[model samples]
Target: MSANDTAAANTGSDERADFLQALGQHRHFLRFATRDLTDEQAGQRTTASELCLGGLVKHVTSVERGWAGFMAEGPSAMPDFTAMTEADFAKRVDEFKMLPGETLAGVLDAYEKVAAATDELVASLPDLGAAHPLPKAPWFDGDAKWSARRVLMHIIAETAQHAGHADIIRESLDGAKTMG
Candidate 1:
């Protein structure tokens, strides 16, 4: 390969590795946020909001799955948020709540599995530049689009933001701390 080609290849590998590293760091913090919490504790809404450690894990997993699906399939693959009924909205709301019989351990295990699958998908992606139109939503611009790489970065940001939220919830639960 020419020098320019070799530089471009290294850049891609580095970018991909950076994305994985960022995602993994937040994922670790999330696990730490739930550490030592029992099933009931994990489900408790310690904060004013509905967020909980187990719930955060569930939401993050769902977010990752949705975005990864968009990357793999296209915008057409995303759920029609606009068409959701009251029942559908209620179900989405409940997705972030750790219901009865749901164990923190179970949620954490599933989160780990999702993280592994996401890492595999990112590593195996053929072209990060593959583009797709954004789904129709109030928050999305009508003309907006994103590349697969942008989707990965979005996941990183989403996980990191939720990790912070989880830290606060965990702290409120029992004075536990995930980070300084």
Candidate 2:
């Protein structure tokens, strides 16, 4: 193969590995965000605007759907949250702050289901260079559309941001050190 072909091949491999690694870290943080916390503690919110462990679990599900749901629909992308509104969204997050008598197992089960769906979404799209016609980012204006690669990257960035929230919440719950 020519040098150009070799470079292309290497880039392809790197993209694949990078996607997997990024998604894996998101999933890992999901679990770590709950470590050593009792059910009540995991459900505690640091403030009115914050996410509890359960909320992060649900938001991750929401984001996975948003980023990967309409790979074929492009510009029409944005997940079929057909009737969901910002209030509904906040409600989902609030649900994580369990009521008087909810169990950790219940929360874990919800997260596991969401994670399974997320893994499938990631697996379904192995190539990032693939293009879709989603509206361009605000910075790029509507002139440019996002590619499959950007979609995946968007997910990575989204999850990493929330994972930081999870880490702080987890630490507050159990006094777990910031690092292992």
**Candidate with the greatest TM-score versus the true structure:** 1
lDDT of 1 by residue, 1-180 (tens): 999879978787578888999989998998899887789998989878988888899989888988988988888878777777899789778779998888888888888888888888889889999989988777898789999899998999999999999989988888888898
Model 2: per-residue Cα lDDT over 73-172, one tens digit each? 5656663344567987776656546656666677667667765665666567656567766544444454556677787788788778878877777777
| TM-score (all chains, Cα) for each model | 0.92, 0.70
Cα error of candidate 2 at position 78, Å: 2.9
lDDT, model 1, position 110: 86
**Clashes within 3 Å, all models in order:** 0, 2
Candidate 1: regions farther than 4 A off: 1-10
Against the reference, the lDDT scores of all candidates come to 0.87, 0.67
Task: Let me know the TM-score candidate 2 reaches against the reference structure.
Answer: 0.70
- Candidate 2: the clashing residue pairs are 75-133, 75-134
Runs with alpha carbons beyond 4 Å of true place in candidate 2: 1-11, 47-49, 72-103, 135-144, 178-180
